[model samples]
Target: MRESLRLLRDELSRINSPDELSSWKERFEELLREAVEKKLGVKCRSPVYLFKTLYHAGFINREELDALLQFDELNDPSFFERLLERLETRL
Candidate 1:
């Protein structure tokens, strides 16, 4: 794990293009969402609340949010709540 992290850091340090950065940014977003889902059970009740939590955690920003949530459409609290609830049921 440490070696993988070191390689990822090296790759990030050499990133040279907006496109490359954007791709990495998307992967980062997915990982972050996964982590949040795992840790918090995805019970967010509002987009604002989710956004605030992610922002506070420094896991996202304006551009990433715009891309990931497609300008906040995916921020639907009901959707996240349902997703978490479903995962909980499965567990």
Candidate 2:
């Protein structure tokens, strides 16, 4: 789990465009689900809750949290909504 989070952090730091988000979001959600369902043994609603749960569990640190926060929210809200809308259409 630690290794998974580390890989996520590294990949997150490299992402600088929307071209990367769809794939990255899938990996992030999968890892969060693994951490919550297996490691932490709980259900998670949103990514924020999953990450904060991991942070409190010591699976993630402050810097990692900041990286995740920036990745998740440092953008116009509609941009992400549109991205997710488009992504959902493929399902």
Best-performing candidate as measured by TM-score:
2
List, residue by residue over 35-66, the lDDT tens digit for candidate 2. Answer: 56775578887777776776777655676666
Structural similarity to truth (TM-score) of each candidate: 0.43, 0.53
- The candidate that wins on lDDT is 2
Model 1 residue 40 CA deviation in Å: 0.6
- Model 1 lDDT per residue over 5-89, tens place: 3344455565677666556444434544555666666745544555556655555555444544553334333333333333333
3 Cα displacement, candidate 2 (Å)? 9.1
* RMSD per model, one decimal: 12.1, 10.7
User: Candidate 2 clashing pairs?
Assistant: none
